[model samples]
Target chain A: MDKTYPSIEEAIVDVPDGAVIAIPGFFAAGVPRILLQALIKKGVKELTLACGCGPLLGATEELTQLVKNRQLKKVIDSYGLFRSATKGLQDPFEQAVRAGEIELEVYPMGTLAEKYRAAGAGIPAFYTPTGVGSIVEKNTVTNIVENRKPKETKVFDGEKYVLEYALKTDYAFIHAYMGDKEGNLVYRKTSRNFNHVMATAGKITIAEVENLMEPGEIDPDCVHTSGIYVQRVLKVPRIGFAITID
Target chain B: MAKKFEGLPREMIAMRASKEIKDGDYVNLGIGIPTLVSNWIEGKDVILQSEIGMTKTGPLAFNDDIDQDLINASCQPVTELPGIAYFDIFDSFSMIRGGYMDVIIMGALQVNGRGDYAGWANPAARGLDIGNIGGSMDLCAGATKLFLTMTHTAPDGAPKIVNEISFPLTVKGKVNMVFTDLAVIEITSEGPVLKEVYPGLTPEDIQSVTEPKLIIAPDLKEIEL
Candidate 1:
């Protein structure tokens, strides 16, 4: 059994700078605020943060600030957190994109998830039906074709295909309901967002637990992420949008 | 019959027949005057589930308490209820597509004789474009009962509820009732029947506003002002 840390900074103390980070939480529901704060306080730069709709998940605003402040290089994402916050992406980072300072790659949600799973499973790329004729599959290079055809056929219809490149990561962050000294995480209510998938998507997974329980304390069936994938655990605070199903 | 809320659009009064909404009913309110239904619902305990996730969503936030976090379908902040269960956009969509919706009230830009609906929002554009579809496609197909509340005509004084619609449709023949400030009309398979009319408005007046030929339901009566 490992010792539980009081704060997330200690939990992810070994995280290297410029590493790809897979963040859990969905649209502010499972955001590990303290864990994110630790990462920001460390002043790590040029890192790629991966997650599903982080803007809605609660980290978008902060990440935008980091990008705008030149603390990070780029973001592979779909939409910004704020609808009315900034000129374009509601972040200074987007202004930088306009100025050619960084690359803002927009990944449709499914494409983003598939790419991460592919990388985690050691697969190079995968095909998804998320962005067929949408603006999602444009700009630069790879074109993975789909074997399926359209409802109606014609020339110049381009192709009904999506080539999702891999989404490799160095660290993952999530907020769980409970955790043991060894880092198994449990989630309550809607808190079970994308934390489990994000955990396996990274090399080093750091979890911020609202409560620290003994090993096997949490029901085996409800245990989402196991201690095997999690490297560190931090005891944190419980905030909003909580519902106890148990 | 109900006391009309002052300052509400003429279209809202016609749609207020939500008196049929019983307790424990799951209702999805589409944008337009249909959203005003939440404010109109006082004595009923019907569960209002928004397509954007929040259930029984409150009005816009006053301050930065805007909870940049939780919001309704219109991209507005909202309060969370106790029984509410948040889900992925895809799963939430499954609920709508699986026909879990009981009643859906939407404001239509156009309602043809067949009761086809066409209001997809910001309809001023010639192209089939909107910020997002959310679950309109699913809601229209899934909801057991559908209601429409809207003005009698377009801003250009052209009729929106009519024999034939010019714009693209969101769902076909999904509308059961159409409500305007002048009158309430029910669309059966046969055609539209004038069900009720507002105070100070006559059946002739409603007929003038309505584009499709209106048949007076035998029990047609005045609406409560």
Candidate 2:
């Protein structure tokens, strides 16, 4: 019943090339940095990455490295570029897309989150009023990636909505503040962003926690992500940002 | 280069927009000038919502309080206020897309006479063939009221308030009001009505930098802080 792994490498050893993987975090906030570094070390190529931010002006070094290494074939994300205020700084991912090195699909943050939520909840598709008259609506025609086919639009009660399909990945990687041997996760503050829903949407969810606890250490009511959704857990030292690990 | 007009400062526009937020209202602030609205509503009853999954967010986190885990939609480290609650992105957007937000202040790249706006992308920006949408569309569609804060014109001095938006639309006909460096305008069925102008600038002066014809409100006066 123990889901704990001895090393980050072993936890993600089965991730194959061309795997559809979801990495949940907003900027540097809740990212599983070490696991991503492991993926970099593992040298997996042609990864189909579904993440919140892409490259993001160096806020995500590991994710950027994956793109810089030419490891990604396609990216599904909400924010594609940092929209930097400063001039002269170039993003490698943007460069890659411009050069036709990779394919990119951008979604409204809500739609992206809901797609994951739908996948985890067993819903095939849902209607939303988010992109009624924008390029987002046009994306249904422009996007050629598989499973990210043309979207369907319908009107209900005189209102227009676009139908978005669920997004399920081969693997989902998440960072947790605390986790138990049973894989129950506890995330902090805003760091909980997409990790909660992504946990259920992945075929195999792997969590890397700053603190590893015993099964009963985390109170039953306090669990953010239930152990049932997680298949592997690795303990990594908390590195970036401020806050005592205690 | 087009002629640039000197108008209100960025903070002044944010202060003017902050007037739209009433006490006890739940507000969501987009990046850029709209993010400055938080500074203006510090002690008010307004609760700031961050799309990255937080409510009742306090000011930017400083030295001791800085926790990478606690951040706003802009990814800046922020402090947690009393009674703060955190949820996942799905529930956060549900609060936004579900019409729970009383007001949302967003930044704009272009806005038309019909109140339709384009914010996420500008075909002009390099490497931005596909721009970031974030939660803007949902906020535009779901919020009870949408206010936009931006410069009166582009940095190159081109009119951003146009007869028709040329850039890609973020959401159509959703903007309720706009606070720019030059004036405060409300989008009405009649057209864009000028409510307030910067001191010493007449409606004509504001119109010079705006593409769409402006309807001057009867009570149009200098912007009062």
Leading candidate by lDDT: 2
* Candidate 2: clashing pairs of residues: none
In candidate 1, position A82 carries an lDDT of 33
Residues B98-130, candidate 2, lDDT per residue (tens digit)?
999999999999999898999987546654456
lDDT of 1 by residue, A90-123 (tens): 3455455545465445444444555666666778
TM-score of chain A of each: 0.78, 0.91
Query: Each candidate: what lDDT?
Result: 0.62, 0.84
Candidate 1 stretches with Cα past 4 Å from truth are A1-29, A32-60, A63-173, A181-206, A216-233, A237-246, B1-17, B30-93, B106-130, B148-175, B178-194, B202-225
TM-score of each: 0.57, 0.95
**How far off is each candidate at the interface, as Cα RMSD in Å?**
8.7, 4.1
Q: Largest TM-score belongs to which candidate?
A: 2
